[model samples]
Target: MDANDLRDLGWTSEGPDYRGSRFHVRYVAHIATHRQGGVANLVTDECRDTRYAERMLQEWARDALKHSGLSQAELARRLTAHLHRAIDRAAVNKMTLGKRAIAGDEMIAIEEITGFPAPLENADGLIKVPMLDSLVSAGNLSPREPVKPEDVDRYVAASGLPPGDWIALSVEGDSMDLVSPPGSVIFINRADTRLVEGGFYVVAIEGDHGTTYKRYRASPEHFAPYSTNRDHGPVIIDDAFRVVGRVYRTMLDIGPHASRRGK
Candidate 1:
């Protein structure tokens, strides 16, 4: 793709944070393996050299445009038709400037229009699991806006997780720290909400309050916090409730932090 036009789909001042975000741990893992041409450590310093990654994209777009025999404006027109989005030559020019990011869908459209091989292809055949861009409280029930099932904060590669209604949520408190600590991103299968005895589940007693991450104890059928911090106790949910989902996997904070990019 000749770049630009549609918009700066993934541009972020903090980093390459954008819609259909490709700046996750799993995203880096796939990059590492491809860059090394073999298995590589996915967590070594996050493997996110934004400058290098952008440079590669810049070069790829330039070469693809040159080889396609399509002018930048023509390529933008093709992209607009393929994506059914308003794309102009200026936006494509911005894509070549290394000052923005491209979302997965945007990149896919470019690949099709330019006939260039996919730079970020699924060479590892990893599954794309959409993640929540925000955090859910694990302590008190902090109220939050409703999130539609289709809102994807980012995409993470899941080699182990089977395809389903799996959504990822980050935690904000220490209440469920034993299993999923604060700052951890927990993956929950929305389709699998049937509470199993002693299994972990996210619950909400009120529509206005944010969901609580807890372990269900069948002894008295109460939602119990799993933290060593006893200040957070078990909640005997009396009101009619909803099980948001059951968390099956968690990615713990494994390194020094950076501010996450999302709305």
Candidate 2:
């Protein structure tokens, strides 16, 4: 349910339709932040009870339904039933537990009423997908963008290669220079080369755990992590090294510093 997963779900923030006027389950929590008073006040309380937030949202949904053209009595009955269901879903006991509250059923009821489902919930239910976070979120790279996905097969065929999963990470150190500098964004492809030879890549290793952005060299037995910096020596890879992925894109944004140097 991180930023990347949201992007992949076709949830764009740029459209007027996506503005606060629309009510999605996940968006409910976000939009609640800007509510005129009551809900916003509850959500903003540093030590506010979770049940309070749930109750406030349930009330808010009831109001929305009334505006949806339902009669007063019908709205009252429907909202009451939904609130009871939400209380059970949220696991709220008779006694208010304050800090231990979970969003529970009320949130789901809100979604059901609004007709927008949460991606994380769907991932757990029908999709059975993995928890995700990576480059597609940071705008570093994408599998398909201006080109529609149905047209991807044609694009891949024209390029003579299969489409790959892309990821991006910030370069932290100077080990990779000349090609990539500190703070550069590097895009990687895990499917590109499973077992890589000599090439720039993002290597994920355990034990001495780290994700290194470097030029990886594979030999008959052992491997080496080479650095473009002349002063830095190659990191010898033993059985301990594991390759997570490889670097496929690099963006250097030194801003005024790069300009000040006139490069």
Candidate 3:
């Protein structure tokens, strides 16, 4: 099971709570035993082996340096002054290059200095989801297809989403308006394809009509618009309509000209 699965079962990184309100002795024991086993399993898991971990460390260190906009010598000096840890440029290079393993204290110091998680701890609370190349229309129908890995623009890390299959889609129109404006990115939980009352969803119709985003309601099925201008009226849902996925979250693009017309 993954970290999320363990969390669902009440396992915490703060360690087992034998005396806590929700705690059972057996549950605590199980957590301890399983956590150890899980660590071992993760170490052996594909893409998380020793080599990958070293590469991840190197990449994170380099990324941290780049993001900090500080030279190695300057960072080393700052680390020594602020953290009160006498780590020199040579030591930083050696650690970043994977020539030396970063100690726990050093990791903590680096995290404090850079305001970024250490490589070994980076994946603790993040889920990586693919950003699809195809745009989902907010006003008109757009062609939809199964997303391949090669078609992914990038992998985006998200948190607090329900555990399920998810895909990212770029908004193409202002139909979703304030909720998901054009140029915004929406995260859809593909597993939640069932029609639900009073929820925004990506939907498709039969034939070559393609897909569009709409606020859906069941019982008297229809695709309702939330736009103020009301350019499009409510579309009556029929047997031809298919609920593709639910829009769980939206990342708005608040660029300089985002408020302008046809943006």
Candidate 4:
């Protein structure tokens, strides 16, 4: 399915980050199926490699045709009749053999014709990032410390993240706005805690003001919000404040899906 179809099915795109531009359609579909106590019919591996997708498409097409008991000619005739597209036997052979790139519409047509799942349903190369129990505030700094690994209760399949100690934190408010809205999942590189330059970071203050997400600049130690919401002001990082982790990537929460925890 295309992005529009995924969105219609309550899936949202978490755009390109360190991994490249891959949609989280399989992940969302898994969540939807899980919530309904149904098995996810699509492949949900977090693979981003193009060659893998191509191979998967070819395999799925062959399997679909074999299971449907329809010969290439019959399938092509049916596709042309139902989709009003000139998909002949040769075109079907090329797609099933992985010679031609399958367009989104054609894939949809194939799924409709063969009663098969979407070919690109599996996530192949994504690593599951742990979601920490601790919450980071996007509105006001809350008094919470980063938790240990034992405190982690969930995992999120993500790509494009730099290799390092990483953890996922949920944004609690809209203080960061466009960059990270409320309920967004932010990935932090735990090993890169030392301040270097101006970028987003999760910081903890000594006193009542706890962890917060903000644009942090090192030359002049201070943290500020990118949001136009003036309720929050810039905070000067002093001896009492500590850098928790650098925010490298984020996944937007599109609906009521719980983070998948490690079993």
Ranking by TM-score: 3, 1, 4, 2
Evaluate all candidate structures by whole-model CA lDDT and list the values in order.
0.65, 0.45, 0.68, 0.67
What clash count does candidate 3 reach? Answer: 0
Q: List, residue by residue over 1-263, the lDDT tens digit for candidate 1.
A: 11131135432243333234335665445544754655665444345655566777777777778878888899889877654467788878877775556555566567667787546743233344566655343212222333455455544544466655666777777898897767777887766779999899877666444567889998887889999898998888676777877888887645433123211
Q: What tens digits encode model 2's per-residue C-alpha lDDT throughout 1-263?
A: 44445457665665323443545666556544543446755655634554455454445544544445544354335534554322331232211233232232333443454443422231112121111233222232232433233222110001112356544455555666677766565555655646656677655544443545667655643334344667776566653554545666676656544332111
Residue pairs in clash, model 2: 201-247, 204-244
Per-model tally of clashing residue pairs: 6, 2, 0, 13
lDDT score, residue 136, model 3?
Answer: 38
In candidate 4 the C-alpha lDDT for residue 156 amounts to 55
Candidate 1 residue pairs in backbone clash: 3-92, 4-91, 4-92, 5-88, 5-91, 5-92
lDDT for model 3:
0.68
> Residue 52 in candidate 3 has what lDDT?
77
Off by over 4 Å in 3: 1-59, 63-121, 135-146, 256-263
For candidate 4, the lDDT comes to 0.67
